[model samples]
Target: MEDIRDRILRPGVNCGQLARAHRAAVLIDGESYFAAFRQAAMKARRQMFILGWDIHSKVELLRGDAAVKAETDGAPITLGPLLNHLAQNNPELEIYILIWNYSMLLSLERDPNLRFNLGWTLHPRVHFHLDDEHPIGASQHQKIVVIDGQIGFCGGLDLSHYRWDSSDHEPDDPRRTTPAGDHYGPYHDIMMIVDGEPAAALAELCTERWQRATRKSIDVHGQNQWDAWPETVQPWFKEVDVAVVRTEPSYKSRQEVREVETLYRDSIRSAQRSIFIENQFFTSTVVCEALEERLREEHGPEVVIILPKEVDGWVGNKFMEFRRVNILKRVLKADVHGRLRLRHPWVGEQPKHGVMIHAKLMVVDDIFLRIGSSNLSNRSMGMDTECDLAIEASSPEQEAGVRRLRNELLAMHLGFPTDEVDNLTKETGSVVRVVDLLSDPERPDSKPRGLGPLEAQEEQFPELVSEAEIVDPKRPLEIDRLLDIFIPDETTQHSWLRAKWLWVVLGVLALVGLAGAWHFTALSDYANREVLAETMAGMARGWTIYPLIVLAYLIGGLVMFPVTVLIGATAILLEPLPAMLTAFAGTQVSAIVLYFAGMKLGRERIQSMAGSRLNRISKHLAKHGMLSVTLIRILPVAPYTIVNIVAGASHIRFVHYVFGTLLGMTPGILAVTIFTDRLLAFLRQPDLSNVLIMIAALVFLVVLTRWLKRRFT
Candidate 1:
């Protein structure tokens, strides 16, 4: 073993911490990774840390031979149950889990916290926290697990649903199903396991993340000897120094970091023989240009990349493909020597679908092996929080191990033996040449179980290409960008410096920023439509919801809340018809309360509260009467409550105010309620027809928004 103090990883450069590990191994696919995790977890004595973008309670962590032991030993096989079982058995063992507070869009795919926290079977020693401390539009995407500071696992494999799969990735693998018995397609991923100094270093990193997320320090109990490494897995490298790289967006006082991105560019420039990559996405232009630069060289290394045929969702696939195609165009144009190959793994014959390659791995000339949660996407490079492990060969044995690892990965993808890949690589000087020798055919489909050329699908909707930057941003959503989206720069210029409409600018931008950020409240934890319906139905039966609903509207109005959001919430909690009527009543009541409050507070107090623009708008409302109030309601001119107060201060007649409120508020309330109901339906059971209908509705809204903007201006 090497000295732990002889660290090669430099902080703020290529890694947060670099240390030597006695043994390090790569576990291909979820079956191997999950099984190994279960084995290592079963050996935990003091503490464990689990962190990831998604951590479902129902993930099946063990199967095959591991499942057999679960039945005999009376230990649960599912991740949540297994951990709880272990915790109950060993009172000294404290398991801490920190998972991203995922968006509402992913609620159905993830289990509610009730399954992990409220269940009677759950053990007290198990601590769980939904991490929401990240910058807007960025997720805590690191997948890392540390067991008692001895053994550590870090990679793209999350302990979540639809992750478990054999290396074969057969198209119709029956084992690929959710806990509720719904089927999924072939999936692929990788996990790296390490012990010795690297394990302890990773433990330190995990605890730091925990402290940031939970505001509490994790007490580390030390042990020099670690025998918890999984017995089934074989070490790929021995006596290796590995660097732990990280990527994080700057937020508040925390500085930004992009070590993974920096290393990718550096490794690409240093490649002597080849660049072999397997990733879910390849859309970062920065990385594409780095490859493009290398490809332009007269005798540069060949570059080979493997990507999935499709992603999970229709919208995500379309957007990612749009971005990927654009990058593919740039790289192919630079490949003057034709030393580039892009491929997708297939079954015995090309089928309707193929394995989803979720591994984030790169081998540059077999001299550097990089693997972890970072996909070759813009978000993974900057916006999203990411972690990766890299080892630059400092010895001949280490260099050979890197070559062997890349060869093994290529062999599995091509459905050939590892030794065959090794031999072919030696026979041919180039990986691109090796793939050609193996895959070239007189006719298409001649080779059943080998690499298939993958190119960008034709752009049926070229308009989606423009949305690549918005959908896969490389940095946090800034307030200035969001403000520009809502209010034009010219509109904010004169007002910002004077701090005249600064409050208004911030208020308006807050609404847009919140949407773009997808930042959720605690209510988002129980955001499933079915869950909301059930919970509210029980509350409704108690005769308690009606008053609380009115109270919420009043409080929300006073705080300048977005009334449409409240309306949408009401729609989710009740039948569509009831929701519309309730929203109308709540808004009308809230309006009257604010209107009277404005009268009592007078013009001076109103100006102090609603800003200087209130008086200007009030005069317009007072003169136009019902028509002005109606127009304001239809447009996003001001907050709902702010308008009510200003209208009260105006000399507008009370009768006209009542009629305008009814006319203006009805359409918005109806639209929000109907849309909320329909959106829930689509989310519950998505189909082509539902998607088409939603598109039509979106187009209609765009036209309406333009008309409203013109009229209001």
Candidate 2:
């Protein structure tokens, strides 16, 4: 049989014909993606707009060998300072960034100690805004950059932190940097560059996103952020029709369209040769289901996936890892000819330190290139907003370029030359043949390698598991059907009987505890006087020190009574003026503990626990780190005790949680301490005005608690 590639490239069925309608170029990995994006940005004559789920301005567009001297300034280049210069130099350049409105509660309300509002201080020429009101919790997750309607980028690479690095991938290279602090690993991502008609289509997509986010039309003609166009950065492919696919559940209600998900399904079904993919996540049941169908066919095309061993964050591992594992199982079952393979790149023997794959891309034969920010998951398909650029090459030269790019990626993975991989493809007939030769399980070379020294170091660490498992796709549960498992069944009489028995047991315990307290207090006059005073004061003033202590105990129960409770107890017992200081200490300790817990739990388990009330709490911990956690704990709206428990369960880190907690709780602690001191003075002296102020404070606390419960729940 003729090889799949040859069949696709054969006369009349030429792969070039599919993409000839537009101009296109292949970005093999992160290095190429950034180079292409920077080149396009520099050459823009009309406009520059970036749309993403999350856009971190600190990301370097060009690094390592691609770092070039600035035309206007002689200083070494960085994206933040350089963009500022570009905007000043070209007044016509309008740079707009639309990112997902990560919940305000998580981003701002939870982190009280942060001094800078990152969204506000990006750049003078750059405009940033959180995209909310797009239907409940839906997000804007398209990673696209358009310049002058001439060049466009669409793929998984986002303008985010820790994404910057050189293709040299030297593990010990002192040049690696991260916005989130040290200890973070490097990353690998991919994107597609296109021009001509395809570029125009991407521009339109950006305009549409801007209109949706801001509810106002934007004119791209006068807003181009770059000076004269650089001819070198122009699109590589010429004259091809590229279709724009988008997903936004909020907008779907207004317009009956499901383009993004449909595109994925149709594209997978249409593949007749080879399907190559690189994604940050691989947990989409629908996509997996489609692949399973293809795998069952004896003549199905080969499937290849490059992914990180796990996602970056702790919550990501808990929530997404399991689903990905399950999805891979399904893929493996269909690999009858051993035509499917999944590989993750690691920098060192320890999986934690190496660069992880973060790119989302799919190349089908040499004809179609699909790039986008959307992960292969249900949430990205329609639940969350997403956008993609699909470019096809119609000419043989373009097809050859695409083919060469694919081989280059394979070469990098296999430690073989791009030319050698291309020759092998021509000689052997299928990608599987080349992959098998380079990826023998018994051979050390078959194991994935990192960029350089990172791989060497990782080799010294414990090896990761590589055995494949099988999953049955037919057992998937529909969303509505799955809800039945949580709902109660018909057993009204039995439930009522159980409730009565539980109430009786609770009442007996309460009576016994009350009697024991009375007996213990009777033994000491001071203890009895303090107990009576606490009861009377709580009833009369609605504020009592005993209740506060009890509240601390409740918090301890919720957060598994972590170190926060002990610290808070110590502070309360020792400190006079700073009574609330203990609460702050406790909350901070709990937050740190939770962060470490989340990181240790990993991604697969997290996804399984998503959608619950506790899951939302976990997400808040992951999204904001310690800052947000401490803020919420200090803010008096949510119970400090509950927050601590949720924090530990969510898996936030210890250092960030502790720091953020200490900083965020300062304001609240001071306020509460002053209020408590004033109340204590009123109790001792019996001042009417002081009593009134205390009453007001009590009322505020009650009202705040009600509001917080309603909002967060």
Candidate 3:
């Protein structure tokens, strides 16, 4: 019988191209990949290329082993220090690191791009660039490491945090912690390490990316002819050929390649026995449609998919899983023969924050294996950059090797040995049946270790988040789509006024707020107005009063205490200029406080406090950045504190939000302070001193407004 892999593994059809790997191995999870990378780098003498969606230098490669730290008199085996040591020690070496110039929406989770050396400022040989050379919304989503063009590592594991776990995936593993000491849940991923032709190919591929990202070309033509593979790493396959494939989105001069998408469909059609998959996300409609095509077959191969139970303890946002459920509903509808099984890994008697499966892998017919950074999602199809490595067994021995790997992965999930899983599958006549027999979440037994059926459950999703394409787009974002999300067709130009008109409206509203507060507080009860004004002015001049005024704004904003009331009170109490300064300082401080609170609480927890309106601000922040924060603040679309909390939970940069708040709040704060102060003075006595003070304040505000408009617009 002809090998099914041979018919489908054609160049330019199923994949973009192919490259041979002399030796290949799969490193499971962060700990394995990190240690392997550290070992390989120690032998690197020429150059190293590090490319990722994110890069952090603070990640500790080795946790408990104080060998490297002890040798260095206490410096840990962190990414930055390791790279620095290699670069500084080797004169022939040049290191290039490229990371995505990401959206601020992920600002809280990711460390700031610390410019090449992480934050430590490593040797000058290290070159780092924050690559924003893609389409506006698309990211540079490839995570690859090539050392000296001799060995390469590629897959879903980035040199970032929230990725470290053993195969056991203990629920309370003490070692599962970030550099900042915050404990995170178990994370699972795969990294494919290859040496020889594949390594050189990866080096060449990412060098092109480097040139595209940094515009500095270096020669990667010559092979180093040295083996850089780690001695301790277990080799998955040897003396076998491997195919390298990719999904590179078209933008500018670059042409789009949907090879990964095509390869998936081709491989699915070629499968005869079973198709097994493990992935971080499962929202790809095209892949699901292909699965549907196969599922409709009366005696088609049984399908098994493994996914994370939820998105909270993992990398994705909540809405992606909500969309995953929507996709699952479609795929399950096509399963007429009960041949498809969706499973999630669990640790305890019941699932409590299930292990985060970050691996992107698939095996078909126990003869072909595919592993890479590409997820089964719309974005991973052709919108984002992706890379994958595949192998087709050309011999019976190699085919059995592939079968053994699939069984081993199953055994790891099922908490059994590879032989047991292999034997059980043969006995049950199907892999899905074996999984169903042992993989039970509803089992009454005290210990529940293994896979459980993946099901769609009711999720708490905010409005507009159900717009799936908005979150996981198949193409680069469109301005029309963003506009459609931000504005409705019914209310056109009139409701949202021009800049000048908006200022006039806000100014009038501020004056009304001052008058209402004065009346509501019964300020007329004071017998002598001059004496009352003098007493208030004296209180404002005291040093201790400033902190008190700021504290009131902080407390008032969080507890839904009306901000206008606090502003009006400040205006009534202090002199015009002093009152304006006080109001601005108070509001900025309160926003900063709420923003940090939102940072610690995260998005879902913030939703519990602020609700659906946060999505409105988040959507804006994603598209508009600083301008969105400014506009929302000026218009007061949601509560003052809610916007700040959402901004903290969103992509808006901290500096941008701070300055935007200042710009947006300046007009209103100035208006309330000046007008309320003048009104009180006028009511007391219509004197030239009060009149001159009001005129001077008005001039200063006009000048400030004109300057701001010219600078920003």
Candidate 4:
């Protein structure tokens, strides 16, 4: 039987039509991509628009010579300065940057001393807006640069701090800077500069994004934003076709396209000689499956990936990295000739202080180039919106240009020169041969040296583990192979057993909460009638009741009681605190009860009953863990009651479930509770001023809740 990779990579299979109608070229690296982008912005004749999930104005594009010094005191280059300079330099240039509206307060308080604060920048040529029109759970994640309707850049690199560094990837280079107060890590990224019909198509995409984000019309002009316009210029590539892929929330009749995944599939199917990739993640099973088939083919192209040893965040590691490592191990099993390699660049230490790779680039046989904001993971493919620019080389010259681009990227990785790369290629005839020659086991001292401030640091921080050994495609999946996907591993089972009693305790507490709410309502009504009447009279005078009602609901929600039941109980009792306490207690109990059901039913078996929707939910929960669960619980966005039940029946531990629920629900509960209490007080007192105060308090709580949710969840 043929191996998986062989079956996947066998030649002569035309999966689909290849669109070739435009030409494109652009040098991409952390610094160069930005420099080229800045140059493109300067040359924009008509309009420039940028959209991203997160945009920081403090990011500096062009570091000053002083940056090389360790002093850290020279004028900090920032995105604002660059845009300001561009707008000032060209009066006709119209630039708009739309960043996701994280929170109203955060945006206003970002930088008070900055000249062009995002909240208050008023340059006529430059405009900034917050994007908040998407559905509650969606984000605008497209990153694009359009200039003069002639050239455009679209890819994964964002205009943010910690994304700047030369391809040299120096270890201790003071020239490298990170906003997080650490030396920059090794990163790989890709972007395409498109001209001709493709450029026009990209320009149209920018216009659409601008309109969607800002609700305004943007006109494209022929005049360039550059200081002097060239009457005519030659095309970078003979002919190229670019497809504009996008994703947004389901709005009206429009459907979001899973462009990132589609592109990945197409690239995998079209590979001829080799498939080279650089990404922050390697987790998607579907993509891995395709690669696995290719690896089984005798003449299949070699697969190479450059990634960080680990992901950056805790949740990312737990959910994404672990899964990714397991999948890669399986893929390696199909590599009979050891044609697949996964490498993480290290400047120092076995683990600590090693620079993480975060670039995303894919090159296929010098015929196709893909650079974009998508990672090889589930989120970038379909969950979070993404955009990419793909250019195909149809002719020999175009293919050569593509090869040059690939060599430039390789040179950056190996710390060599363009001409040197060309010479090496001439001698070796392929990247694989050149890499092998440079990386000869016996000649470690003869490898091309990285230049600049990091040279000394590099020596101090030599590779502890062999790169080839770590990434050898011949390695078999070991421990992971013994573990079943649905079955609980030893750690998971231990965790569940350890936390089992907690669920029982919570269930009992919920009953107490329910009983308490009922008892309080009865007692308050029976004995506090006069006080209740007085409070009601005061409320009639001027106070609002909505705030008090909201408060009751929040307290009930936190305790795991039905919101309606808690509200009714509180109103009947005329005692806010008891009603709130009862509600809170009840909700906790409900969660406990649900958890026990999950433990008994088995998470996997229960999940199967719910079908794909629940399966997706399970994946999301597994990926994001307690944080995501808590977010959904507190917000009550996606059937919180059902989730509570399903989560209990799932693999999530009781402790995580409890902690996440308690923490995530706090904000919403507090806001509603405070609102309810204020409204109740106002209704009892009948003071117009009190009513106004209640309104103000309600608004404050809402805003506060929203802020807290964004910060933590």
TM-score of each predicted structure versus truth? 0.68, 0.59, 0.66, 0.58
Q: Deviation in angstroms for 562 in model 3? A: 22
Candidate 4 residue spans exceeding 4 A from truth? 1-23, 66-77, 88-91, 102-120, 133-137, 178-183, 224-239, 245-252, 348-355, 416-437, 448-585, 588-713
Best by TM-score: 1
Candidate 2, 184-221: lDDT as tens digits: 45667777766555566667767876765555588655
The local distance difference test score of model 1 is 0.75
Name the candidate, 2 or 3, with the larger TM-score value.
3
* Better TM-score candidate (3, 4): 3
Q: Write the per-residue lDDT of candidate 1 for residues 423-465, one digit (tens) a residue.
A: 9899877788778877766535344556778876766446554
Which window of ten consecutive residues has the lowest lDDT sum in model 1?
497-506
lDDT of 3 by residue, 1-713 (tens): 23355577888877756677778888877878888888888888888999998877888887655334445533347888888888877898898888886543344456644454465786799887777656545678888999888899999999977876776778887878887898987678888899888888889988998876655678774346666789888777877777788888766446788889988988998888899999989989889989998898998889999998875422255347767877788878889999999888877654465878989999998689888989999989877888898888877877787888778888888877789889988888798987886675454642446887788776544332524454477876543233334433321334232111001111112222233334335652432335544555566656777787788789877864567667888787667787889889999999999988877774657555334334543544566667777766665334576567657876678898899899888777877777678878867988998888778777786777676544433
List residue ranges in candidate 3 displaced over 4 A.
Answer: 1-5, 65-76, 112-117, 221-223, 313-315, 350-353, 440-448, 465-467, 479-713
* TM-score for candidate 2: 0.59
In model 3, the worst 10-residue window by lDDT is 498-507
What does the lDDT read for residue 66 in candidate 3? 30
Superposition TM-score, candidate 3 onto the true structure: 0.66
Clashes of each: 0, 48, 2, 57
lDDT of all the models against the reference?
0.75, 0.55, 0.74, 0.56
Cα displacement (Å) at residue 603, model 1: 28
